[model samples]
Target: MFVWLTQFILFRLAFGMALLLSTDLLASKQLALNSQTADFPVVSYCVDPDWLPYEAIRNNQHVGMSFDYMTYIGVLAEINFSLIKTESWSETLDKLKNGECQVASMLNRSPEREKYLLFTRPFFVGANVLVSNVDQPFLQGYENIGEQVLGTVANYRQAEYIKNYYPNIKLKLVDTELAGLKSLASGDIDLFVGSLLSINAQIQKSGFSNLRIAGIAEPQDILGMGVANGDQVLLKKLDTAIAQLPEWVHVDIYKQWNNVRVIDEIDPRYIFGGIGVFICLIIIGIWWQLIIRRYNGKLVAKNSQLQALQNELVEKNRRLEFMSMRDPLTSMFNRHFMQDRVEQEKQVSLRTNVPLCLILIDIDYFKAVNDQHGHVVGDLVLQEIATIVCSTIRDMDVAARWGGEEFIVLCPNSNLDDAIKLANRLKDAVSGFDFNTVGHLTCSFGVAQHYAKESFVEWFDRADKALYTAKDTGRNTIIAAK
Candidate 1:
């Protein structure tokens, strides 16, 4: 899946004919298979008409790698993706935001878009590279761009990345990659950086034989399809359809455009950027050909196999994400999740006009146990406490080990009395439980009800003090903030 998407994203950068060819009238291929299927949805979407290799509109038709991939997905799912006419990428984005378009293609995920768009799993990784005239060699180090005028698409995130991070670089903002290349060709801008495929396409059309890739940029882009936030049904259907296509189609479609080469296992975001990794992987996986042939022979069996793989992939990704949010030692929610989830839970209570509570617990004399039983037994005690707390608390309550032997719980829709009761219950449970020949142990707990208009830290501080009171007054007890 990664190979196909990466190939899907960078496939336009194919060497040789792609570099030499100027006009092939690139457009999406329509599929006639399984049109009679009943579950097919007629999805309305808009594409960026000027973004080549990824998407483009030439002679009034939606075309490019993105459109072709979607058309193939439509065939697999028996859906009709009706294209909505739009003038530019900005207009396409506006249509999506305004609900005129139900879907938008080739979207990069970011913090801002989450408010309006639900992004699907990324379809491919984009390795953005600098494009300059061959005569003017440039370095990949971002510092080299300090004194140069860089041409980039206006309102594009890359423009923002450059402006915000490298303010020293003079920006020559253009409306499209073609415009950027044009600006570069005219020497109006020192150089331009864009998707490898996009710059190559523009270079082929510009008749600029001197145009060559200058350098690859950091943080390679991840491209995904987006539906308006809250449109889960459409998003699920689209993801499922896209996942079912034979992986080779991702590579095959690109091969028709240009010859590709792989560089390394590069994410560009974190490591050395590798080109043509997908092609190399595809070459090595010869057995998949039998499955592909069988799929072509029998759609039902192939669909079943693809669906199984899709489920497995989804499950694995979910588990990985879930595992990342926990403390490995105690199998409790980690401090990182505590920080984020507390904010989320606070917002939920505020939105619903309900009370929230926080409880902080510290294992009394935890150091003594570690000193006597050793670190291994101390770890076991923490794990056992986590299990006891999780099982004793309400299902809606969240539990986390803040640090060391101190555990915190976030209780939604609970008031002072309710929180105190639960905290006392937790304290008693800890006091009663046996610790595998390590003898008995007690915990100090502080409980506080959230007050309206109070900051999270303020409320937490109150609870934390009450917990220390538990420690000072006596262990194995709960104290609620007065």
Candidate 2:
């Protein structure tokens, strides 16, 4: 029995040793396969040659957020990137289209780009802002941009979006963001749209204190790397690398580039002077106490005067607040005030499951009137139209001067059909009303109801399209969006 047991133990030991050796061989084979798979060919990449804080080609070297992200991703994926120089973003896009470059370091994905490139998942997201001269009033939104000559970078996603949605806005395309900003600073363009980071960086670098952010624009910048559509393998590798990236790495890179510090140092002389002033105040307080009884009547009169000044100051502030939310000529709500009201009403409509609608009105041939009758007469015409619109709509509805020769109405608890009816009434009122010197004028209207879960921009876009259709078909008409 002892000899039989010893033979069984020996058999078990041999079997275990063979299984361990097989497992080791399989692991070694997998390691070799992985190493071979990581050996990818060098990639040629292009960047916006002038965009800073995001990506740029400076002195023939690639630098900025894109560079840092690609460096880490390349190390992880075992790929190499070679810089392909270009003079401008437009040129960079041209090179990518013609296959001169295999990748774009950072750009927003667009339908036109999808024809030739495959985009990786977005790695960086930032807001887009409207920039204008310091003297310009705060813009309500892009939908109210009117006929201003807006500047945008050539080949930028924003340029395409504005062209497709807000066709009324006159776009002046520049080669780069820097060029566009410079143009804006020089008053060559009314406004410029760009990513917040790049805009801030350029403004600081160039000391463009004359320019200020007017307002936030629709559609934030969602940026990702783009690879040539033909290179599926490279695209897959890049996607995997981006997915494997740590969240901390993103925060770190953003901080490294965007961190702004303001250091305020106090001079010792100022500190000493402040101390001396405090001491003098204490001595003065003691002296004043001795004279307090003698000056009681004077103090009472002085306090009365101060109180009257405070009352006047309060009244002025109230008037200022009212003026801020109103168009001076029309005495109606301005676009800035209406934007906030629309957001609030939208939220209420969503929460209560009630209906919300918007109507856009444009004065037909209004510019002709301005040219023929001059701006003073044109102002009177606008004021009259505003009054007619106010009288035509219900008190629950909100109206605002959308921009030059344009206005918007927001209706709560109203459906498309009801909104269309309201717009018709407004159109008829404006058509029948007579401007004293300008004679009779007509208006075009576009009406749209908010769809469930749709964004403000989408709703506004539908209405804007309808308004354009009304103009195209003929003036003095109302059209409802489907």
Candidate 3:
């Protein structure tokens, strides 16, 4: 009996070992194929760990809309799957570059990203929306939201859009949609802005009775997946998978998220009748005089409050119009706005018979910094140089972005000496500063004092010509038109 038992135990151990070996072999195969398949052959599927209704991990298992979609693809292709989860968007992107993760799910389709990543046919449609508490007054439209603080995710494209176009509207950024909703509930933010479906699912799961899903805004953008560049096979497979999904499936998904509550405007005749009936009912009460006086007082207060808000809105609009002329990156007047100012300056220059000078500044090797350090650091360098230049120039002088990595300054009523001096100061200041990862850098400047009979193009050409001279002479110097 003892000999028989020993033999059975050995057989069981062998079987278990074989099973383990098979599992490891499948996993290894999946990893190998993920790496060898494209330019970025090693695809890492990077996803936010805590984001629910879109992508999330629950009980150590990847799950959500995107997770389900990926899982389906893996099964259909008969490939064993290995999923990687990341807590931050940047880490996901890093993993893809480091050959750790090969694919990013549910990214916005953008022409700019096409340079580095391969995109699949869109699997789903998403719309940006404004979400608010149920207890608050319903949003008839975005305009009705007024100056309420809108919450959005940090480092998100939508945040940048709102920042640029609606500067007067209050914007608050949290790291995640969960945090955005938390801020809204805590009164830190008035409304949370995000993808309608994702935010709706989150709100539903939170079980926050007071919170509500407001009407979705017009979809400003769409979301899609990104694979590492040159993954044509994977891209084609994704396209096929998406095409296979029936139209009803998409409709069902949309139906689940279209939780936006809309209120219909009351008919004018009904409103008038209702108000008259309420007045008559109050008049017939025992304390009729007192009721009427209190009612009128409340109406007056509400009217005055609305009037004040209207005036404030008008003022905010005026400020927005003024700020529209400014660049968000540099806080200087932007190129198009500067053109209008230049025309005005031309009128003034002609009236006073004074010269109008132009200086064109280009940061040397700006693209190199971007390639070496990253776009974020390059943006910081541009901001730093803009600050230095703005500080060096007189208040009357106009500085503006003349396209990428180039700045144009219009010096009205200033001749060659003033332009050259200012240009030299700018060159020195930019060269002296160490730009974080980029380190110390320099800029080239071309200074041109206008000739009385010169056309705008002629004056600009002279400045541009001098700029080339500065570049040719080795950058970090100022060149003035002779």
User: Which segments of candidate 2 are over 4 A away from where they belong?
Assistant: 1-38, 135-137, 260-482
C-alpha RMSD by candidate, in order: 16.9, 21.2, 23.0
Write one digit per residue (lDDT tens) for candidate 2, span 169-263: 89999988889999998989999998777877776556565676777776667688988846867877887778666666687778777743222
Indicate which candidate wins on TM-score.
2
| Deviation (Å) of 80 in candidate 1 | 1.3
Count the clashes in each prediction.
Answer: 5, 0, 6
CA deviation > 4 Å runs, candidate 3: 1-43, 75-81, 97-99, 111-115, 134-145, 248-482
TM-score of each: 0.47, 0.48, 0.41
Instruction: Score each candidate by Cα lDDT.
Output: 0.71, 0.78, 0.67
- Residue-wise lDDT of candidate 1 within 145-231, one digit each (tens)? 767788888766687677777888888888988878777777788778877656655654444544656666643556778887458
Ranking by TM-score: 2, 1, 3
Residue 410's C-alpha lDDT in candidate 2?
97
Candidate 1 — number of clashing residue pairs? 5
| lDDT by residue (tens digit), candidate 3, 137-251 | 6454356668878888875666766666677777888888888888888878888877655665565545344566554443233455677755767766665656454444455
Off by over 4 Å in 1: 1-39, 134-138, 259-482
lDDT of 1: 0.71
Residue pairs whose backbone atoms clash in candidate 2: none
